[model samples]
Target: MRKKALKAAFPHTLPVMAGYLFLGIGFGILLESKGFSFLWAFFMSVIIYAGSMQYAGIDLLAAGASPLYTAMMTLIIQIRHLFYGLSLIEKYKSAGKKKPLLIHELTDETYSLVCSCEPPKDVDPSLFYLFISMLDHSYWIIGCTLGALLGSLFTFNTAGIDFVMTALFIVIFTNQWLEQKDHRPAVIGVACSAVCLVLFGPDRFIIPAMISIALILTVFRRSLEKEASDHEDP
Candidate 1:
């Protein structure tokens, strides 16, 4: 069952693997250039797993930022995960023993894949999701390790590499848009985020945007579900 699940999951993760490898490599090179070792890259990628936050974390660690500040920054940056968790609550509720690990491993890429892909009927859904998460995580760790090793041995400019993540998000968003018949959620998210960005400025906009999105979705939950049901029926 697990083997079948893994086989089914791997193909779905190929795109994520490509993105993570390059982004992870960029992170590792940046960290190495800052005098950290491959160990740091490996551990951070394995443990933190928040791609953007981890990149931002390099500066925080280097500056010896206060723990409180670090905590706050991490929360603000990762606030969207709260929404992801909310969406997956029902799907993950019955995962039993796998629930904890699934929650722990729920990075943005993992969340996107899990939300978008369903396991083949022959494969166990839990195992398929687990394997997808594991594969993506492993790709990141390997990429970071390689980049750190190369950086330590040689020198190269890694500027503009972080755009990989932005590109990945754009791709994911586009795919989601194309796949869905109802554009309400996407439109709400973009409109709210743009409004917040203008009103609160970049550094302070995420929380407000997230709040607006959550509230709007919660209020319209019944209608959205009905729309989805209607779409599926026809």
Candidate 2:
């Protein structure tokens, strides 16, 4: 069952693997350029495990940000995970011993893949999810470590490499849009974000955008679910 689950999970994570490795390498290089070692890259990828926040962290470390400030910024940056976790509570209720790890490793990419893909025949859903999480995590660790090592050995222009994460997100969003017949959720998200961006500016928009998206989705959940069901029917 585990073997089958791993096989099924690997293909779903390939896109993420490509993204994470490149992004992770970029992160490692950035960290290394800041005088941190490859071990820092490996440990952060394992312990912190948040792509965006980890990128932010390098700046924080360099400036010697206070722990309280770091904690607050981390919360603000990762607040969207609250919504992600809420959406998955039902799906992960039966995860048992694996629930904690699942919650720990539920990055944006992993969440998208797990929510969209299901286990094949005779494959345990829990195992499939776990395998996907583990594989994605490993890719990131390897990427970050390799990037750090490369940075130490060679000199190259490292400007704008951080944009890889943004590019990966665009790809994920486009893929999701193509895969789902229902576009209302996507439309809602984009509209809310755009409005918030204009109103609050870039730095302050994320939390408000997330709140609005969650509220709107909840308000229209029944109708959206019905529409999706109708579309799925023959």
Candidate 3:
């Protein structure tokens, strides 16, 4: 049954495995270029475990960015998790003392796996889900360590690896576009980000755009739900 559950969970790992390898490798190379070692990359991936934020973390760590800044930005980036947590509280309640840490491990891929799932009667679904999350995370640590070693040993240009993130996002957007019932949030997010970039300049737009988009979605959440409902009814 564990093996069956693992098999069931494997397909869901594809996006994370692919995205994290590319992003992790890019992060590893960048960290190596900044004089950090392969061991450092492995350790960060093990301890930190955030994907996009880890990319930004290089700047934070290197610049000695304030703890207040780290706290604030982490809140902003992960605020959507509040809603995810609220919904999952019941499903995850039995996690005992592990509850808090499990909540912390809830990433884009992990949440997608949980939310998009139906619990099986014969298998312990939560344990299987948790195993998948841990495995995906371990792969990241390995990838980062490998990439750092590769970077140190090789002399190839890694400039193009920057697109690793962009390409991953594009793939995510495309996947959600296909399977997602309500496209408005995704549409709005892209539109808002593009508009903000044009108006606020690339460096200053991301947080502001995310904030504005989040506000609009929050205020009109019912309307978005209604829109999804109307489409379903039709």
Best lDDT among the predictions, by candidate number: 2
Q: Candidate 1's residue-wise lDDT over 1-234, tens digit each? A: 888899999998887887888788878888988889999999998888878898999999888899999999999899889988989988887788898888888998899889888899998788888899889989989888888888555456656755656676788899999999999999999999999999999999999999899899999999999999998885
Q: Give all candidates' CA lDDT scores.
A: 0.87, 0.89, 0.75
Worst 10 residues of 2 by lDDT: 153-162
Clashes in candidate 2: how many?
0
User: lDDT per residue, candidate 3, 50-164, as tens digits?
Assistant: 7777777777777789999988877766665665686787888786765666776787666766766565677676776776677678768877888788965546665576464
- Cα RMSD, each candidate: 2.2, 2.5, 3.9
Which pairs of residues clash in candidate 3, taking residues 3 or more apart in a chain or in different chains?
none
The list of candidate 2 runs beyond 4 A from truth reads 152-181, 228-234
Error of 1 at 131 (Å): 0.5
Q: Provide the global lDDT of candidate 3 against the true structure.
A: 0.75
Winner by TM-score between candidate 2 and candidate 1: 1
Q: Which pairs clash (backbone N, Cα, C closer than 3 Å) in model 1?
A: none
Candidate 1 error regions (>4 Å): 152-164, 232-234
lDDT of 1: 0.87
